[model samples]
Target: MDTTALAHAFTQACTREGFTELVEVEREAHGLWDTHTHPFEAKALILAGEIRIRTEDGTDRTYRAGEVFHLQHEEPHAEWYGPEGVRYLVARRSRAG
Candidate 1:
């Protein structure tokens, strides 16, 4: 599906999953790898391009458009993008649970 349809589907899924907010973000086409942590839980849906994610000491996974990934609260992880960069929709839940 296209970004628009994927965005809408992600919004609906977020609502069902009790996410309080949804945001769409676009990453530029560049090779960047960074490690970070988030205070809230992130449930994201890939809308375009590709992403490779690795937890601090866990397995790594590559996610492409139409794929979904979850990041838990305070989970330290690193990520890098494909040559085309990526566009994704993220839904955030305030509570750790």
Candidate 2:
């Protein structure tokens, strides 16, 4: 996928969807993160590389470039990047309902 193009499109989509605080994130290779929760709803688009997200229910899903993922407010999860690391665009919004 064209990461640069995807990032730009992702940012635009986030704004159109009423998401604020959009930002770019890059993780290091082989990075491992512990369980955590989001303060608000969040969404992200995978621009490059891959990530494995572990939900509170113990399900692990790996997302690669060109995929999107979301988390509800206060959702519990953990994530780690593949050996080559990952880059993505993320946006957050106030929770409704």
Give lDDT tens digits, candidate 1, residues 1-97.
Answer: 6778877878898889889888887777766668899888999999889888999888799999999999988889988888899888899998744
- lDDT per residue as tens, model 2, 1-97: 5778887888898889889888789999999889999888889998888999999988889999999999888999999999999988889998876
Model 2 TM-score (2 dp):
0.88
Candidate no. 1 TM-score = 0.87
The candidate that wins on lDDT is 2
Overall lDDT per candidate, in order of appearance: 0.86, 0.90
Candidate 1, superposed: residue stretches over 4 Å from native: none
Range of the 10 consecutive residues with the lowest summed lDDT in candidate 1: 25-34
Stretches of candidate 2 exceeding 4 Å from the true structure: none
State in Å the error of residue 45, model 1.
0.8
